[model samples]
Target: MFDYADLLTYVLLVLKRAKLPQHENTRQVLRLVHEAAAEQNVPVRLASDLSQKNPFYALLAESSLIQALEIFAKGAHRCA
Candidate 1:
């Protein structure tokens, strides 16, 4: 079974790997990402790569996983 906390941890790990500090905003972003991710039934791995496809790395470099998850959920909802 996929653990949500593990997934969230992985997101944080990736950010830290990219040299993002664990600041107040960073925690907020993680929480948002967690909530958005939970809404989409998104798995841990996809959550990790959700921003990897951007040519500008816009999502990965700027927006947090929560924002990406929100976009994913919105699109998924619209398509459904």
Candidate 2:
């Protein structure tokens, strides 16, 4: 399994990729998002529906977002 920083990078990639307009093909991005967020139980498939702008930056509600954070953070601890 990847360490936290690696997964963090993956999460960032997912978030950045989600910003593209809906008309654009996002299959690959979504797949990465699923892979990155799967462990955390974050809703990756629908995350692209969320805005890339201010307020509610993630498609996940606050609690699920926290879970994703925890998942990444735990990875960090494992490497320490």
Candidate 3:
């Protein structure tokens, strides 16, 4: 499974510099991506180039992103 926690700090840093809404926006973006990907199969083996792959990478990424988004969103935002 692709873990977003490992990527969170880097992503947050970019968001911070961009002055983007942090947690809430992250959740929204993740959710939108997840919904968009519902029809396509996720590739299990991720390649920067096209090659043999499993079909779960996208789903896992989406789920992981959503999970990460929620953790920060609810933890940091009282309204969440």
How does each model score on lDDT?
0.46, 0.44, 0.35
TM-score of 1: 0.21
Point out where model 3 deviates above 4 Å: 1-24, 40-80
Winner on TM-score (2 vs 3)? 2
Question: Against the true structure, what is each candidate's TM-score?
Answer: 0.21, 0.24, 0.20
Which whole-number lDDT from 0 to 100 does residue 61 have in model 3?
A: 41
TM-score of 2: 0.24
Instruction: Give the CA lDDT, 0 to 100, for residue 39 in model 2.
Output: 56
lDDT of 2 by residue, 14-71 (tens): 5664343342336754665666556545444444323322112223443575665665
Work out how many backbone clashes candidate 1 has. Answer: 1
Off by over 4 Å in 2: 17-30, 34-80
Over the stretch 1-80, how does candidate 1's per-residue lDDT look in tens digits? 23454455556644455343344356544654666546645444434433323111135556676776776664432111
What lDDT tens digits, residue by residue, belong to model 3 across residues 35-66? Answer: 43464433322211111121122234436666
Question: Which pairs clash inside model 3?
Answer: 42-55, 42-56, 44-54, 44-55, 45-54
